[model samples]
Target: MKNIFFILLSLVFTSITYAHEGGHGTPTKNWSFVNNNETIKADFIMKVGDMVYLSNENNEVLTFNYSEFKEQDQNYISEKANFINNLNFTKESHRLKTFDYSILLLLTGILVFVFSLFSWKTKPKKYFVTYNLFSASLIMMGCANTKSSKVLKMAANDIPFLESVFGVFNKVNTRHDDQYFYVESDGIPEHEMMTGITNWQQQVPVDHDYSGNNAWAIPLQPELAENTLSTKENFMKGAIAIAVNGIPIFNPLNNRGEDANVIGELDKWGGHCGRADDYHYHLPPTHLQTKVGEDRPIAFALDGFAVYGETTEELDENLGRFTSDSTYQYHAVKKYPYLIAAMKGKVELNPRTQAPENEIMPQAKTRGVRPDLRPLRGAEIIDFENPEPHQYSLSYTVNSQIHKINYGWDTDGNYNFEFVNPDGTTEKSHYKRN
Candidate 1:
């Protein structure tokens, strides 16, 4: 009897709360995804990290990954949410808008008082049936008053804070509105590369297209994930973060889940060229501490948290800790999980992907001019030189025998390659960028 009474009582409070929540009569718009053919109607509410909240005609809440929406809908959702969230109310005015619990007490007290009078004027047995109804309604009102408010407070001036972090670097460009900060670059660093790589994959660095729509994005007001997802056996396909010098940073573990740095696949500065000849780092670029400062962040994770070089304090299970300002940050350590153990902030996974091969959405893509290459056994990248702009040469050794590749590109996007074999045989090839 008590359980049944509570259920009825709770519905009354819920209905009342939703009726006054300001979205009651709002019209919903059709929303579709890049992958899904079906569309749903929902009213845009807000963007929290990588997720967006919406409401239906019934005012019931719904949420989806932000990247799941089509390009145009994404713009609308972000813009609409910005306009709504910006209309902040003063504390005094806000307090007035809050639901008044006194009315609930008064209404329920009247119902109970009226029933009490009827019980006293007549046989109490007849009124016993309604006692549960009145008592439960009063209890429900009390519980509703204690429920936590759903209003989420976003971190303000995040764009300015991030600008300060990347301010010292000249190779990267940044811009933002209200939701996200986008960074554009060529995906190559200005520092020395490939000289310290003991294990060679027969690949050399090249400029990759990472501008415009393919630019990297970081959430401005990052939110914590409901459940922390570990980095192990995940985020292997794309970069986990990007260094301040415009270089992408991949997981310390290679796609096969082995430590790429410990396995001798990375150079002294912790970077290497991929199979696509696109350069990125598999470990923390702590060497950048010389430029960005030891106490500062050398990179920013895709989840929007800063990746600091070294810290004296201990880290949590995720290799991060909440700062004195109450914000979270990850540290770069010398051991395993060099930068991040798990994402400290919320992020969206590619909708078409699963685990291991799955990567974060909104990241830039790499375009290669040549076919993907395989590892050359016993090969070591001994030297890399950019004799002039748009021209580069790489030297590697296999069994102490020197081999070289001289490559360059022209204004027409035509690439010319000359390969010199260890036996002094030379071959030439050409490709046109599409």
Candidate 2:
């Protein structure tokens, strides 16, 4: 009986062991190759006992029990699944809801503050504190709302800009890239060689060849000119032009051209100035053209300020031989506010047949002249009084035709000009004459 009982006990113990290992089957041993360039070889070994061992021929061994490996694997899988699920749903809806809430809060705060203004029984000190707190809250809420909108816009616009800017580089840098486009010219394209505009290709003339003066000049249409002269349009154009032109555009009242210099100084101190790269001369010379005919000498002017190249002996001679006391250099002054304001649409140019009353005739001024008015070191001047009385004709050549530009500032300190073709046909720019 004792022997039979012992046999039964041994059989029971064997059955229990078999049951524990049922799903696991045999003592399975497997190896997986994880070919890593960083190491000679990384191999994972698993045994039936739920033991995992990681071996890298070039490094030390890492070992983990079955439970630990299983837990880590499960965690990784869960995280990946969650990420995929989130991507499937639209996250923008939540962002929009948050933005709308911020906007509503801002508006509500403003309304409450405004209504508080009419309250009659409030103590002065208490009222002041309350008003300030309320105003601050309103401002914060408004800032939050603006931030949300800006973020959304950046998200939408950033991708396209990145692709446009970097895609070209990637295609050219990668080999076997036959699908890419190459820009060809006799030499490097003029726009490529020029360093001003961020996206010069967008503004470049598509239908014209850029080999000569025609390439340098842009055409002026009545409607386009009208649009460009509008307060917002003018400001935007000027801002964009300055940004791309790599030059400072200034306001007439502030005729101090020092902003550009200040910006350069800041850059030396590790500060970021404008978005565009720095490229301004302390006193850049004006661009000049040789006389083509007996007609008026064509000169390119911005606002009412004429562009002049550096004074050479010939230029000095042309200025009627002024002595040292009378000799003065012409500076390219940028009008930032006028250009920026025009860009912002706050102002408009009204084109009309009637001339501006504030128009200062070029011929009325003298040669070798400087403005008698003292401008602060950096102030921008739209028009300077010619110290020397001299008559000069002005015209802009665009699309292979020369159109005379009428020069003067409006009463409100805006540019007023017209284009006259060789045939004597004149078209006005859009800036309402005061």
Candidate 3:
């Protein structure tokens, strides 16, 4: 009997030893292994026909057959192996599970005690139930408020950043003067819908002109030459470069002597003249010269509008047509020069028939009438066959050390538009201009 008992004990020991053999079958391709003091970790490609067996330090074996296991089982094995490999010397999942179980048990015990106390007396039962219910309700309310607070904070945090990214513009000044000028337009009457002139205020004086001082210089010579006045091209390019590459410089209008006339000319035809927010024409007038002889004919004031009539005779006839309208006439103020440069090649002899360069002119002249420059209204009938109108804005940075510029454009249909930096990088936004 003694011998049989010994044999049975040995057999049990042998079975455990066999089960504890720690290596898996041949360790499939790309397989790796790690043996910590507590667990043996195995990592391997569990492809078709792959079989793996794992053993803990206690000699308990776990076997996995890749072909037989479900997808979830395979994933679990992978995660388990990863956790084992990354385990630190001081922490393990087993310890976490034990702690969690302890906490749950403690909570259960407290709940039981509380239940017993309430059941001990019928009078106290309702009070106890109400107290516990109220406590739980308060906890839930606190948690909900905390979550809502976090959500609100996240929503509010990025608004300012987004506004800065998009860009912003504010009213800089306003003019109260009421003046009527001969604004060129398509054959349509001045009442037609357009975009550029919404809430348009009278032009402002640049500098000392408002101070009741005649010391402001006015331009005596405004003439057309191959390269006579500062071209809008060069001035606009410089302004844009400055805006994009450096800080912005707010240049006040020039009111000194001959500069005033230049300012006036620029106000009429320069600056960002489009209806959209992206178009930019920064050039305005700067200087003036007086004609002395045939080499220099009587120079028009810098602010004077260059009206082109049907013929040379008409041009001569209309030179002083609005002479009495002071607001419409040239003031010889030094204007912002950059916008003037952009106006070059943009103006046409007849705005209705002759298209402005780089613009989509209105078409479909019905009954010999066309639309003029007026504010756009939502749902206004537009001729889709014709090139849609557009608007543009200019932005630039100017610093002593660097300059940068970005020009933006918006199509009238709100189909396509882009903000283009001088460096050729572009950001696009979509909008529909009704």
Best by TM-score: 1
Give the better candidate number (2 or 3) by lDDT.
2
Candidates 1 and 2 compared by lDDT, better number: 1
Task: Rank all candidate structures by their lDDT, best first, as comma-separated numbers.
Answer: 1, 2, 3
- Top lDDT hit: 1
lDDT of 1 by residue, 1-434 (tens): 66766676676666467435464575559998999799988888776545677777876667788899999999998887677555532433443444456356546756775776678657575455556466556645554543433333434426666787677788788888677788888777888788877778777777877778888888777777644555775788898888877789998888898889888999878889998889999889888889878888888888888889878786665778877664678998887777788787878999887777678877789999889788888888888898997788889888899989999888777889999998889999998888
Q: Please give the range of 10 consecutive residues that has the lowest summed lDDT in model 3.
A: 241-250
CA lDDT, every model vs. true structure:
0.77, 0.29, 0.27
Weakest lDDT window of 10 consecutive positions for candidate 1: 148-157
RMSD of each: 16.0, 29.5, 30.9
Q: Worst 10-residue stretch by lDDT in candidate 2?
A: 217-226
Q: 113-191, model 2: which lDDT tens digit per residue?
A: 7766766355465554455455556546555544634421111112232223213322111111122111111111111
**Clashes in each model (backbone N, CA, C under 3 Å)?**
0, 48, 53
